[model samples]
Target: MEKLEQEMPLDPFEHIIFDYFPVYVEADVEAFLDLTSDQEKKKCTLEIVHAGMKRAAQAFNWDLQILEKVYHTIKQTGYKSIFALLKKSSPNKKYVCSIMCHHEVKRMDVYVEIKKRSGIVVKKEKLFSVKNTDEQDLLSEYGTLTWTLNHKVEFADKDYKKVYRLTFLEKDKPEDLVWKMERYEL
Candidate 1:
């Protein structure tokens, strides 16, 4: 726990923006929806989402202000889906590998690009787009987004250096923004 604390400092508002990692990655939302009636499916899904959010907030001991913002964001933007990027380094830190969750929206997709470098030269690159919105254009009823062009990863672990960055791009202008970077132990 001490080393964990020293390495990857937890972000409290993570649960709000993204679904629970690993578990959500393997979750079958459609299968779960099939278990309920048409009228109850949406309701049940919302309930499950709310419950998960509440539980995550509790687990992290986040402040009320953060929770409130999360609630309002979900209320406005609607929790469409999450994009998870799992990046890991090879032994000796010479190489890196990345795995991103695949999500699809109706209209347009969000593009993601990652550049991993060992020194001055770029070592590897990973790029993809996940569709999770139906907006005709960038602007929509929900809100605008915050574009984070770069996030530096300074620390590396023993076995395989791993880090994750989650960015949210909304349609309308959102005042308070949430971006997350996390490291997982292997």
Candidate 2:
């Protein structure tokens, strides 16, 4: 694993804008299975989660302590999940976007909070509510999360052309899986 890490190029800061926690968790589990000692497994899990939390804190502009608290809550809840937080800005408005995926339940939820320049949230809305279909499972056979999205989905409505198109991995199948949401205005 150290050799692999050395061979790979450094990830840019922007890469953390995507949800990669599930992949890290899955890798840690696989590594744990190969280790014979309990101490080694514990160390592996802690290292993976800590690295992930660091990236998440930078991407979300959150304090590390806050992320640790959220991680503990997720651990207590016993749900394997991935999430991303991003901030966007326009000339007149600012927004905070959140995307969360629960692999066990095969569900993903997207939300946006519209805020003023002063950082007061004015509105919150659900941008997408999606579930894994038979065609696309949230977790691949290898146990890695396989959820992704394309930001450019065409819609007849002029107000919205950026509806998301989600894709996932097909369980027990090697073919790529895709699921397009029906026309729904945001």
Candidate 3:
């Protein structure tokens, strides 16, 4: 994770915004010979969650302590299975974020507050939501979080085009990550 963070050429003073969401998954077992083992399903779910969190932290310039705490919280919570919409945060200096629990996953909700901000978030939106079991399963399979937006504005007879692409790999290895912003004048 440290190596990944170091590779990004982000402005130290710029505020970085990040979106957080929970992944819900279920494992069904009919018999002992069931090919889809419980452990395998759990591993897959955890990997997807971890990869997403790690990439978001890197992109938003989160502190090492914050990253550690988030990972620890997830481990404590046995991934009981729940769906949540993406929560946006404009982390600049100090902020509070949700931390999951191990026992009674839904009942043991906890929030962790951090004292420093490594980045800032510029804009936030409810990009995606998981409403039902079907959607949950679909996300669990190829659960890559991606956002693409295009906007056009006119000012004094001049036109400007803006595009933003945000992707957090859930199906691919963490080592292969490409994230950046580009500017073009028209």
Candidate 4:
């Protein structure tokens, strides 16, 4: 059996703002709500989220004073950056991570093992920066990357969980932000 490591006490503010990983928590909450479609299930999910925040507080042993700093860190750093730093320090694990605009750019360094392939030859190349937030900016950044594909691969992963999909369609050579999101749920 393994014992948990001793946690250092955090200031008061840190305790309050724990578990502010909003996106994942929102997904989990949505999943719970869709599972049973009942009020009891909704209440249970809310309780679960509440308990998770409390557990995070207890794990860090934080108090009220540290909450502001904790919130700032969460707002600025995000959960992925910490994970990205750890991933970067490790050797040859076949993963790459970086920050892009307000999102995380996580890619598998291991040549994505395509079960099926795409034949569309993208004879283009583009340079991108982290500060570019506009959709047009992203398109322009990736506008020059020329990738040549020779196989028609099924885009969807054949996994049990519902997989959401998005395909970016560019109308002009400069490329526009007019991409569309299609989903199984929709």
Each prediction's TM-score versus the true structure = 0.26, 0.30, 0.27, 0.19
lDDT of 2 by residue, 77-111 (tens): 65345443344444223322233332333346544
The CA lDDT of each predicted structure is 0.39, 0.42, 0.35, 0.32
Which lDDT tens digits does candidate 1 get at residues 65-180?
77677666755655444443445453335433343343332333333333335532232223333254433222232122222243333222222333234433222434443334
lDDT of 3 by residue, 64-89 (tens): 68877866676677645543322223
Scored by Cα lDDT, where does model 4 land? 0.32
Worst 10 residues of 4 by lDDT: 82-91
Error of model 4, residue 177, in angstroms? 33
Q: What's model 3's lDDT at 99? A: 18
| Clashing pairs in model 1, backbone N/Cα/C closer than 3 A | 104-131, 105-131, 143-171, 143-172, 144-171, 144-172, 144-173
As for lDDT, the candidate ahead, 2 or 3, is 2
Winning candidate number (lDDT): 2
Q: Which structure is stronger by lDDT: 1 or 4?
A: 1
Tell me how candidate 3 scores on lDDT. Answer: 0.35
Model 1, poorest ten-residue lDDT window?
1-10
Task: Give candidate 1's whole-model lDDT.
Answer: 0.39
How many angstroms is residue 134 displaced in model 3 relative to the true structure, after the best TM-score fit?
Answer: 7.7
